[model samples]
Structures are given as C-alpha cells and as structure tokens.
Target: MRSDSMGRQLLPKRIALPIFASDALSSVAYAPDEILLTLALAGSLAALNSVWVGVAVAAVLAVVVISYRQTVHAYPSGGGDYEVVSTNLGKTWGLVVASALLVDYILTVAVSVSSGAAYITTALPSLAGHEAIIAVTLIVILATLNLRGTREAGGAFAIPTYLYMGAIALMVVVGVIEWVTGNLGAAPTAHYDLVATGGHEEGLVGLAGAFLLMRAFSSGCAALTGVEAISNGVPMLRRPKSRNAATTLALLGTIAATMMLSVLVLARQTGVKIVENPASQLTLNGQPAPADLQIAPAISQIASAVFGAGSVFFFIITAVTGLILVLAANTAFNGFPTLASVLSRDAFLPRQMYRRGDRLSYSNGIIVLSAAAIVLVLGFNAQVSRLIQLYVVGVFISFTLSQLGMIRHWNRILRTRQSGEQRGRVLRSRAVNVIGFMMTGLVLIIVFITKFAHGAWITLVMILVVFLIQQGIHRHYETIRSQLRVDDWTAKRTLPTRVRALILVSNFSRPSMRAVAVARASQPSAIELVSVVADETEERRIRSEWEESGIPIRLTLLSSPYRNVIQVILQYVRTRRKRSPSEMLVIYMPQFLVRHWWENALHNQMALRLRRALLGVPGVVITVVPWKLGEDAEVEGHQLVNDPFKRPTTIPSPSSDTLVGPETVEE
Candidate 1:
C-alpha cells in the first residue's frame, strides 16, 4: 500500500496481456455482429460479405498493432499516443490526441459494458430491457477493483478474459471440424428469409453497395479500439517494459485477428443472420417475424449452432463472453487513469488526478471514468447499437495522429547518420508507420463520412469540447505560475510592521477561553477580546465573565442594531483595517470539533460564516482554534500538557486603562 511498494505492482506479460488486451479481444463479441448487421441491410446474400469485411478490419488491426509496437519502443513513459503526437507533432496536436483518446476511453467503457449487458440478456431472457442497470453495476464493480490497484484488478480479470478467449477458440476449432465432416448445424434464424432494403435490393451491385461495405468496414474497426492501450501502459509492465508491451501487442493482434476472422468465417458457414430491423427485414414462412421476438447476437447464435443450444459448453461460452465484455472496460480503467495522470503532470488536468491513492493507483481518474461511463450508459439506455455509433471515431483519430507522429519520429532519427543495418531497420519501421498512417487515416475518413450523421458528430463535438477545456486548464495554471512568481525576494518575504490579534468571543466558555489563551501566547503588539452583542444582558454577562477570569486583554463590544452577528464583525474588522492598512490583523475564532457528522449541523454555523466573510478581506488572517468535544478526541500518542484554559496568575496586562466602548468603530 505504500508508495515504495509500487515496484511490486509491475505486471508480467501473462497478466498484462489480459489487462490491456481484453478490450480488443472482446470486440470479437460485437464487431462481427456490427459488420453483419450493417451488411444485412442489403439482404442475406449481401450479409455474406461479413467475412471479407472482417478481413479488411483485421488488416487494419494488424497495421495498427505493428505501428504501436514501434511507439512503445520509442516512447515508453506510458503517455502512449498523446506522447507520441505531442513529442513529434507538437503540443497542439498532442492535445488533440489526448482529447480524442479521453473521449474514446469513455466510449470504450460505455460500449463494452453495454455490449456485455446485452450478452447477459442473450443467456438470461428475463434480464432483458435492464441493460442500463446491469451495465452501471458492472462499471461500479470494475472501478472498485481498480481502486484497489491495477495488479489486483489484473489478477481478478485475467481468468474471465482467458476463459472467453478459450471459449471462442474452442468454438472456432469445433465449428471447423464440424464443417469438414459436413455436420455443421444451421443457426436458429438461418431459416428466415432476409429482404433487402429498397435501394439495395440488388446487393453490392453499384456505388451504393460499395458505400455500404465501407460503412461495415468502419463498424468492424471497433476491434482496434484497445490496441493502443498496451503502449499507454508500458510503465505497468515488468523489466524490459517496452519489449514486453510490444510482445503483448503482437499477441493481442494475432489473437484478436484470429478470433474475429474465425467467428466471421464460421458465421458465414453456419448462415448466421443479424439485422438492425429484424422485425421488418426478416420473414418466417412468408410471414413477418414477430415484433417481440428476441434476436441473439452473431456469437451467441454461432455458439448455439456449433455447441447445441442448451449444452454446458453453450452456457460456458455465453457466460464467459458476457463477462469478458464487462471486463473489457478494465482496459479503460487502466488506461484512462494513467493517461489522466500524464495530462495532470503536464498541467492539462487538475493536480489531484496526478496523485496516487493509498493503494498507489490513480483513484480519481478511475472514479471519474466510472462515473462518465455510467452516465453514457444511462443516457443511451445501455444500447450497444446506439453507443457504438459514437465509439471508433475518437480512437481512429488518435490512431491516425499517432502513426503520423511515429513516421515523423523515424524521420528525425534518420536525419542523423546511422550504420547500414540500423538504417535498414529504421526505414522498415518508418515504412510500417507510413502504412499504418494511410490505413488508419483512410479508415478515419470513412468512419467520419459514414457515421457523422449517425451520432459520430456527438463524439467529435465532445472531443473539441475536451480539447478547449484542457487548454483552459493549462492557461489557468500558467497564469497562476506567472502571478505567483516572486520578482523581489526581500519584499515578498518581509514581515508585517505589527501583529494585531483579536479573539471573537460569543460567551464565557472553555473554547472561548482557549482562543483568548492562544491569542495572548502569540505575544502580539496589540490584543483585544471582541464581541458582537445585540442584547445588553448578554454583553453584561460576557463582561462579568471576562473580569472574573482575570485575562489581561482589553474587552471591546461592538453593538449590532440588527442581529446580523457576522455583518457586525465584518464591519468592525474592515474599519480597523482601513485605519491601519499596513499591519496584519489576526482574528482567532473558537470552534467546537465534533466526532459525528450530524453534530456538525449543531455547531460551527457562525464560525463558518465568519471565516467565509473574512476570507476576502486584505491583511486579515482567520485562525480557527478547535476545541475537541468528546473524551476520545485527544491527540494521538500524547496527553494534553495541561488544561489550556488554566488562567495564568502572572499575565502581563496591556498598557490600556479601560475596556473600549461599544462605538469603538468610530476610532
């Protein structure tokens, strides 16, 4: 739990793979579904294009993984794409990437958790229509685990992630075997006839069909969402962090590509049909499918066809699929906080985000990510179809910018002379980045052009807003630094000419006596016991107690025509400050410190108001002297030296002859 113990939290490749790769790996659950759904708009024959669409998506995923591997090697401080773009492309572009990544990270959590909730409904029909509640609960749980520390979260999530991977792998292997043996069963919905939309009845025949394919490709690119996280998380890995991270990236790319392509291939073989408007587009026996019929996701249908609907393996696959979807949010849990800490260190975010919690994790960023994800979930009602519309836009923005930065990075390296082998390697890296840039850049354009009207514009607007907010935060910090800079050391450190102390007394109590004792101990040039009184009887009682206590300070009463105690005190203090502007006026306020929360309401209302009112006054210091209210409120490991209110018999009295009058404000 100590800061020094952070080294113990370093993750090995096995654990890091699951933690950083879960999001990308889980994309196989829904990316294929998205691809098929988009393709299904053009009829079942057009839906057969799902395999090639997945192939194109996997190719981009491969290039992005390779490009980020280079990124991790070059900039392993864990700033990831933001650092890459900032260091090579400059801070403005860097901030653009940061904002984009921030928005994407939020959408990642929202989309992943929502999709997982959908999977839960796939297996448990009774839980349908409550995806928002389920998704919110999963986010809260992930946030709590991550608050404990990244390593513990990794350990907890590793099993389900691996289980999901294994489930997919098994389904793929079994589906292939069943196909070769000619025993592959058809999906439950395979019997339904799909009707192409009016414009696309011809199915991939013209410019419209090509545009639809591009749209499907963009939707399938969601698999690339979490690939960059490994680069962002190199600091969390063990020794040789970059190499381990790069290796994990390669592993993630291979596994995700394999799972996605295999699922798509198997979906084609098993004739799995998914459509956006299932009630309208699908027909059974020449009749429209029932409006209330629930359509299972592509993966669930594939699992049922390959492993039998009610089999144990079927349940295991669906269960693990749902769990991995939920755990995919863990990737954002790890990356968002780390990225936020970097931004905070750079003064783009609040300094509190840069601080580690007791468990040595960025607790503020995790909680913030959780809250944002929950809001998005509730706002969209936990519908993956809707949330996915806003998903990949930000991530691809970061991707395109990072690859461009990497190319620039290599160019800078090549400007300096290198040996033959080194030059060859650098050129190869640059070439890879170039390919990555073109691929991701093209994908970014396509995604924006295709999805802009379908809620991607919301993401773009959010990114721009985040960018402007960070710029403002940075400007604020810069302004503070400039203003607080000490140009003249002597003048900045010089003490006030005289120290004048005033104790605000309401009645004769131990707390008030303690405040008076503290004021006298300060040995100020002048001291006064001041009271704001509206009632003559109360003033008389306070004067009586002061004389009986034998305190050497002069007692001054300020009369309040109205019972505005705080206003009366403020007027008196401001008038004195106007009279002696160069001296420091220290106001000692006695307050009771209670142990219970409700007890706060019973006390300190006046002290709170007085402190707030005096805060803006120049040359005024409000000092709160807390008197503990309970027996157990003693200072730890030490007893009180003596009773603070035990009045000293030999107190040095002030040179004043008598107490000031109620109208002392005139002087």
Candidate 2:
C-alpha cells in the first residue's frame, strides 16, 4: 500500500482491543497455573490459597489499568511510559523506562509462545519433547503475519482472541452452575496428594510461609505484562484515540481479571493440582506419581471437571487457549515496534527503526524483536515454568515508574488550575496515580526480591546493558552534531586552490575510456590516468593500448610488488595530498551495472573496495563511472550510455613539470 494510505490503517476499538490487549487477557491461560504451582510448593492444603493470590493480582491489574487510562488521555503521542517518565522526571529516567519496556516486550514473546507450546503438547502428547522447536516455528509465522501490517494482523488474530475469551467465560459459567447443582466432579488428578518441599512440611507457618505467599503473588502478577501496550499504541487508534484506548484498557482489565480469578476459584473448588516438580512433589495411591506423568494445566483440569473430559467443549476450550496464548505475542509485536519508533525519533536508537516498510509498519523493529525472542526460547528450552522466573521484573519496573510519573503529571496539572471542577478531577486522578504508584512499587520490590536468584538478575543485567548502549549512541550522535555544526557559512564555503582529476585505468576497454573522457570533460587543472601493475602481462597490454590510442591524457603506472591494488593507489593519493594540501583530488573509477544477481559475480569489485578506503582520507573525493551491461540496458530511470571518448580537442597544461608515462614507478 502507498504510504499515504496510513490513515486507512487506524484501528477501531474492536480490532484495537485484540491487537493491543491480547497479551494481558491471554495471561488467564498461564497466570493462574503459575500461582497454583508456586503455592503447591508448600502442600496440597496450602495450594488452596491460590484464590486469594488471584484476587490480589486482579486488584493490582485493575489499578494499573485505571492509572494508564489517565496516561493515554494526557500524553497520547504513543511514547507511553517513556514519555511520561522523561517529561516528568528526566531523560535518564525515560531511558530507564524504555530499556525496561524493551526487555519486558521480548520476555512477553518468549513466555507467551513457550506457554502456548506447552498447551499444544497437552492436547497432542505425542509432540511433548520438542516444545522449543514448535515455539521457534510459531514465532517465525507470527513475524511473517506482522510484516504484512498491523490492521491485517489484528484482523487475522481477532477471531481467536474473542473465541478464547468466550471459551473461558463459558467454562466459568458452566463450572459455577455445576457447583450450584452439586454435580461438579473433582479433576482427574484431584486424588493425588501433594508433598511439600523438605523445609515446608508443616505448611503456611512462620516468616518463611509469608515470604512464600509474596513469591506466589509475584508469580501471579505476570498477568499485568501487556497493560501498557494500549498506551504505547495510542497513535494507531481511530479518532477519539485516547477515549477508545482507555475504554479498551477498561475492557481488558475487567475481562482479564475476571477470567483469572474465576479460573483460580474453579481450580480450588475442583481440586486441580499443579506443582513445580510433578514427579517428586505428587503421589498417587502410596507411591510417587509415574515418572512420565503429564500434569494438565489448571484450565484444562477445570474444563474437564466442569464438562466431561471427553466432551467436545473441553477440546474446544483447550485449542482456543493454546491459540490465544500464541496470539498473545501479537500484543508485543505491536507495542515493541511503536515504542522503538518513538525511541528512534528521539535519537535513542538507530534511525532505521523510525522508517516504515511497504506495509506501513516498523519492519526493522519487528524483525529484531522476533530474533531476540527466538534466542530466549532456544536458550531456555521453551520451559514456561523456568522462563516465568525471568518474567515481570521489567514490566513492574516500567509500571512502577510510569505510575510515579503519572502522579507527578497530575500534580503539575493541579498547580496550573485551582478552585474549579478541573482541579477536583485532577486531584482525584492524582489520588488514583498515588495509589497505583504505591501498589506497583511494592509489587516491583516483591518480584525482584522473590525471583532475583531464579533468573530476574538476567533481566536487570539486560536492562542495564541496553540503557548503557543507548546512552552511548545518543552521546555519539551529539558528538557528531557538534563537530558538523557550521558556525560560519563564509568559512565553510571557502574554495579549494585547484582541482586535479585522477583516472583509474585497468585496460584499454570501453569502461576505462569512458572514465578518462568524463574526467577530461570536467576540465580540471590537470588529468592523469593511473594504473596499478599487479601482473606483468596485464600491465604490458594496458601500456601498449594507451600509447596506441594516443589518449590526450598522460598515463602513470604505480608498481605493486605486493599486488595490493587498494593500498598502492591510496599511498599515491595520500602522497600527492601531502605535497599540495590545498588542492582537491578527485579519483574516478569504472564500475559495472548488472541486471541480475549472478551477473555481479562476473567481475572484480575493486571500485567498491577503493571507494570504501578513500572515504576516510581528508580532502579526497571518489566518483564511480558506470558501464551498463546485460540486456535491457536502457531501463527507465537509468542512463543507458556514456559519451564515447572523443579524443579531447586539446590537452590542458600539466600542473607540474613532471611528465606522465607508462614506465613503472615505486611509491
């Protein structure tokens, strides 16, 4: 599509919801499981606390959504947390937010795809051991879809997201009705007993138990990872963007929190057991569970109990759950690129990231995010449980900082207006942000403290590395700007003392003759055709042709005993510049224009090498004289031919007394 059609890409709330909130909403698939698994580390009885953990996580999710609603309305330029922090605090704090979000977005993809792979294997047990391979394949597919464009991806993924939501809601309603009727049966694994860790045999006692509960709560907070995506993507929304984005955030919070809490409540009622290590921590009858036991996730168990295990509804819910989990990465796919484009605009990243592709999407950022996620998935073997340990740290960091920035944002507004309805609203918003700041700040600390040893340190280190690298890039750009800044146009426009053209001649071919003719046309102070003598036979042919052709320009040969073409030519150019510092030296070389990729392999790329080496030399300029090859040389937008070397009417006087000839001279 043409770039002008970007306006057509603005997403309405229906499509925008799935595109931006799928990650947070799809957390229902695994967030409850994580809470249950962490609680099961104590004992079967202690696992019952999952309901309370789910409630805590849901409450936090609600507050974060409310806080970001204000963010979208106040700063709808799509900078999200980075803009909030940078505007309120400073650029350094903004960099902190950007680095955290970047790392978190990558982890979102890795965790979501890995969790999706786990669900797939649950349905098809035959594909159990190759989760990493399946996950990598899924990522490649997702990347391809996103490369097509954002609105198209949203359209492709919307049905599955809605179906997953409908499936979870249906299961919850069915489970509740069965409970009311006293017909809900226990899960298939409900009969197995959980054995607590060695130190927690007594269960939920002492400070250790309190610490364990905090860890479980932190694990459940993974549900909040994608809440900021809507705020980051405000620019992609249709008109009334802030209002639509806030509405979407509200919808996300309600649906995601309700689904998560319902799943945990259902798991508790139906006695679905999941543990960190199912083999050693669970027992059937009197012996440890079978070594190869496959523990279905909490949602699957809940579905099986609510609807018979063999029921079609159970498989439908399972399939949709797996698909939604994979589609959840689409949220990051949208957020990461938009956020990267913002950073790129601010000069914190490469300028390439700021340009849109043919699809009007940030293609570079999408490719980069996919590559990073694939590395994480492969490195961790696509184990959601293990990968979850490294999750949420960066997100909570961003959440905490964003809330604090929002609080400051409201305070600034209140100071500007007093004694009116606007002041009252500003004060209320400030109160909300203050609460959000406190809640998220505490959760951030809990996540870091609970998961640091497990793998959260890796996240912190990555954020630090990204921050330093961006700082270095910004500083380098600043240095270049300062160096290139022109203080006086008069001094900058001073002319060179003389212009000397040097033609790079290889043989008496049409390409070489064209180079000499173009150089002579320029009417420089002097023109000298030079060649490097790499082989004796080639050198003799060139010397014979130059004398026979009687080219107006003189020929000079530079002997290369080491057969290093580029170095020999550069040495001579530098020596000439050292002798006459104010004269401008223009080096012209012949180059081929190929019609096909393979045609390029037929000739040497000496001109390319020479241009690269000459670029860094002071007061030197290089030009390429193209010689078109292959059929269809007269392609539109490309010059078809060059003027033939008409022996120049007259040769200009040489700048120096030195006469040029074919005799070899050592540099």
Candidate 3:
C-alpha cells in the first residue's frame, strides 16, 4: 500500500534542470519568432529591429532571474510569488498574484505543447492539420508522467532538455562560425519578400514605432515565463536548497538568454522571415509564395542554414528544439503543484492539494493543472501565436507585486531591527527589491498595453474568475468553521436522558435475532423490531416466522406503498421524533459484510441510503450491526459457527423479555 501510494521518484539535479528549466529555455524556440512577427507589421525596416528587441528582452530576463534568486534565498519555502506577495502586501494582493500565476501556468502548458506540435507537424508534413489533436495527446501523456511522480517525470525530461540545449548551442556556434567564414548561406525562405498586412505598409516609426517596439519587447518577454519555478521549488533541491536553487536560477537565466539572443541574431544574419499569414503576406521575388510551402519555425530555419539544408545536424537541432518545447510544459508541472500546495496550506485551495502522494509530491495539484491545460489547449486549437498573447501578463503581474511586497517586507523588518550589520543587510536587500519593483512594474505596463487587445484580456478575465473562486472557497471554509465551533455552553449541555433503540429486521433470521440481542443489551427505554413490508406474501411469511421463533419482542410492520424501504423508515423515524423530542432514537441497522466487488450487486443499498437520510433528523442516532458473511467471518473458538448470525463471545446477549416494552434505560 505504501509503495502504491508513493509518488514517482526523487529527481536528481540533471533531471530537474530539464524538468524545471525547459519553459525558460524552450522560449528561445519562439521568442525570436514572436519578435519578428510583431515587427513585421511595420515592414522590413521594423522587422530588422528584431536583434535589438532580442537584446532588450535578454536584459529584462536577466534582471528578473536575479531578483528571483534573492527571493529563493530569503524565503526558500517553495511559495514563490504568491507567498512573497501575500506575506508582505497582504492577502488580497497575494490572491491576485496567485490567480495570475495559476492562469500563467496553464497557458505555459498550452503554449508549449501547441508550439511543439506545430514544429513537429512542420517537420513531418504527413501530420499536418492534426496539431490540436497531437497537442492534446501530448498533454495527456505529460500529465500521466507527472502523476506517476515528480522525480520520474523530471528524470524523463533530463535527456531531452540537455539534448535541446546542446543542439541549440551547436547551431549557434556553427552558424556564427559559418557566417564569419563565408560558408553560411541564406535560409530556404530568405529571398521571400514579405508584403506587410493592412494599410501600414511603410511601417510606423517614432512614437507609433516605439509603441510597436514595446509590443515586440513584451512578446519577447515570453523568455522569462519559467524563471519563478526555482523559487517555488526550492524544497525540491538537494542539500543547501536555497543556495543550489539560486545557482540553478542563475544558470537557467544565462543559458536561456544566450539561446534566445543567439536564435534572434542567427535569424537576422541568415535573413529568416516569419509572417502572420504566410501565404498572403510573404512573397518570393515579388510573387506570392506557394501556399503548399510550409514555413519552418525560427530555430529550425537557423539550424538548417547553419548546418546546410537537410544535414544531420539540422535534423538534430530541429528534433531537440521540438522535444524541449514539449517538455517545457514540465516547468509548469513543477511550479503549479508547489504553489497549489502553498495555497492549500493557506486555505485558498482544497486541503487535498496539500497532501503528498506516496512519493511525497502534491499529486492532486498535478491533476488539476493538467486538466486546466488540456482545456486551454483545446480551446485555442494549439496555436502558439494565439496563446502567446496571454502568456506574460500574469507572470509580470506577480513579478511587480511581489517585488513591491518585498520592499514592504523589508521596511517592516527594519523597524524592529537594532544592529548596524543587520540594518545594513536589510538596506541592501531593500535596495535590490526596490530596483526589482521599478523594472518589473515597467514591464508589466508594457505587457498590458501591448498584448491586451491581442487576447490577453481573456487571460486577465480568467485570473479574476479564479480569484473570485478562491475567495468563495475561503468564505465557505469560514462558514463551516463557524458552524462547527463548540463552546463551553454547548459542550456542557445534556446529550440525552434515554436512548430508544429500534432493531430494524428484514426477516426472523439469525441476523435479525442477533440484532435484537444487541439492541436489548444496550438497555434502551424502548426496544422494538421494525420491519418494512413491500408485499403481502413476504410480510405474512416474516410475521409467521417471528411468531414461530418465539421472540418476546413485539414486531411492528410499516407498509411501503411505493416499494421504497428508505422513505418509509425515514417517515416513521420522523413521526417518532415529533412525538417525543427529548427521547433519542437509536436505529440499529443490520448489514452484511461481503467480499468481491460484484457481490455488491446482489444486495440492496437501502440501508446505506436510509442511514444517510436519518442523519438529518434531530435526536436520532443510526448504528450498523454488521453481519459478516461466511467468507468474512474470522476463525474462532475452533468451530465454524455461522459467525454472520452468531453474536461474538466477547459481547453477552441480552434477554428478549426485558427489551419487549418501553422502560427508561441509563445513559
């Protein structure tokens, strides 16, 4: 049982890197594309600015990564942005950030999986038009891997992540060397002339262009999506968790920024072109390119240019890039559950989210995140460009608020401080947080302004919806707590002076006889055999059997006009309770214990349903007198006595005559 309950396994650092860093790293695959696509609206000149935009994006990513490193060091509790914001800014801000992060994580999975499927379909033409199906399938598979356990999923991702890094690095090096040596040539689509869409063929410059530039920058900010995972996953790190996680964050940032910048530079150097509507906007030598010709992703185009078209190195780069994008969803798998566990601890989410599986991982969180991602993937048809618009808004929202919260946290800490050394440390940390706030706040404004119309509004709406739901959950828990509160007055109040035990009998069988004996032993004020009659023949047979058995207890029969036993019993109990409100009615129900799942089909569940309904009645108590079947009976007393019908030797049977009428019984 323990083994079955355990999570997949413990993840080593090698596996953890790909499992957590894939999102940040895989952004390199589409970061350049997003920049170029956004710039293409302004014609060739605007598109030419992709390299500078890439540089700016890399800079911001570096800052964010550094800021999060500090977060990991200070907190190291695996709460990430939600914890930081809530602890410092207050619960409202914390919940806001939590909602945003939740949506962002879901978008992460949707965007990554869809981008991966798109790349795969591009490489293998036979799989075209099946992008959504393929993307959903992959999501399901990844979810299963995660459900198995975190360590196992991480280990599964390790090789693909390293290969992806190695492939991209190789392409960057080879492309640069080839270009410098004059061996590199144009990409297959390099000569294609892109016709600007809409009326802005001249491309906007100055203020208009500046706005576009910010949009491009915001799009490129996709590179920073997974940087916070380290902060949320500090506990998953090895010894010296904070230090290791901080180091890992730095390494991830450096590598991701390098790859993103490399891809952008290479695309620019090789004259790679990407358009929104490739068939309509892209022309080859002033003629529209054939609709049948597929445009490869930005990274694949660079790989082919560097390694020569159709080369082994080109295929390797393409395969790993595609693989890494799919695995990038793993970062969300790592972050989402940990954050959910934090929210669960705070009562913002269901308590089950905090419980660990056999592997000591938040398995419930994994399932919830996966379900959310699947819905988004299906809703968006697995289109990366469409989904990318919703990507960074949530992340930056949290980033800005968390940094500001950190500032507040530092101020509060400083007020209680005494030592100069401690004060100096606090001041330095406060300085970093201040810088972080300004930087992230700027990026958040840019993201909202640039991406809101493109589809980000939907994401914001989702965040708000989630926020309301969380609030409702908190409210519900509070109401339940209030209702359950037991004060001294309530606790000291009387329970009951007497118990009226009713033995529910189906027939005058050994089981019913045993139930009567137990009920009598309880010494209730009133003891009676209550049986439900569904048909005349069965009722007469039961009555005759009772008389023949010579049981002294008076048998009371209730008619079930609709052939419903539970309803009849419920009505009878209600009538009794109304007559004597002070008396406690203990309904002893006879139940048979049987093995084999199919055995349940042979017996009616009326007793179970009846007990459930009886719970709502005041002054009513329901108890089950379980009659174990032959297979369920334990071997005892060296005889195969029908244990199901026979009373246990440990409990002495009561005399039937003493329990025949109403008489007050001691509590």
Candidate 3 root-mean-square deviation in Å: 4.2
Q: Please give, for residues 30-90, the per-residue lDDT of candidate 1 as tens digits.
A: 9999999999889988998899999899999988998888899999999999999999999
The runs of at least 3 residues in candidate 2 whose Cα sits more than 4 Å from the true structure, single-residue gaps closed, are 534-541, 593-596, 630-645, 648-663
Residue pairs in candidate 1 whose N, alpha carbon or C atoms collide under 3 angstroms: none
Q: Distance from true position, residue 647, model 3, in Å?
A: 11
The residue-by-residue lDDT of candidate 2 on 1-667, one tens digit each, is 8988999999999999899889998899999998888888899878989899899999999999999999999999999999999999899999999999999999999999999999999999999999999999999999999999998999999999999999999999999999999999899789999999887777778877888899999999999989999999999999999999999999999999999999999998998998767788998887898877778999999999999897999999999999999999999999999999999998899889999999999999999999999999999999998899888999999999999998888877777847788788888999999999999999999988899998999999999999999999899888888988999999889988789888887787777866766776676887788898866786788789888887656788888878898999889999989998988999998876777889779868788888899898888888888877653334223222243345334645455522456568685
Q: Identify the leading candidate in terms of TM-score.
A: 2
Error of 2 at 302 (Å): 0.8
Higher-lDDT candidate of 2 and 3:
2
Report lDDT per candidate. 0.89, 0.89, 0.82
Query: Candidate 2 has which clashing residue pairs, if any?
Result: none
**Candidate 3 C-alpha lDDT tens digits along 1-667:** 2555333344445666777799999999998899988888777777888999988888888778877888888888889888898888889999999999999999999999999999899778899989999998998898888877777777788888888888888888888999899888788778887676775566765677788889999999999899988888888877677888888888899999888888888898898988877778788677787877777888888877887878898888888888888999999988999899989888899999988876566789888988899899889888888999999999999989988988887899899946999999889888888887898899999998988999989999999999999999999888898977877787558778666778888886655655666675576766677888877786778778876766556677887756877778778888888888888889898776676778989988777778788888877888887766673335122232333234456544344533353221111
Q: How many residue pairs clash in each candidate at the backbone level?
A: 0, 0, 6
What is the Å distance of residue 468 in model 1 from its true position?
Answer: 2.5
**Candidate 2 lDDT:** 0.89
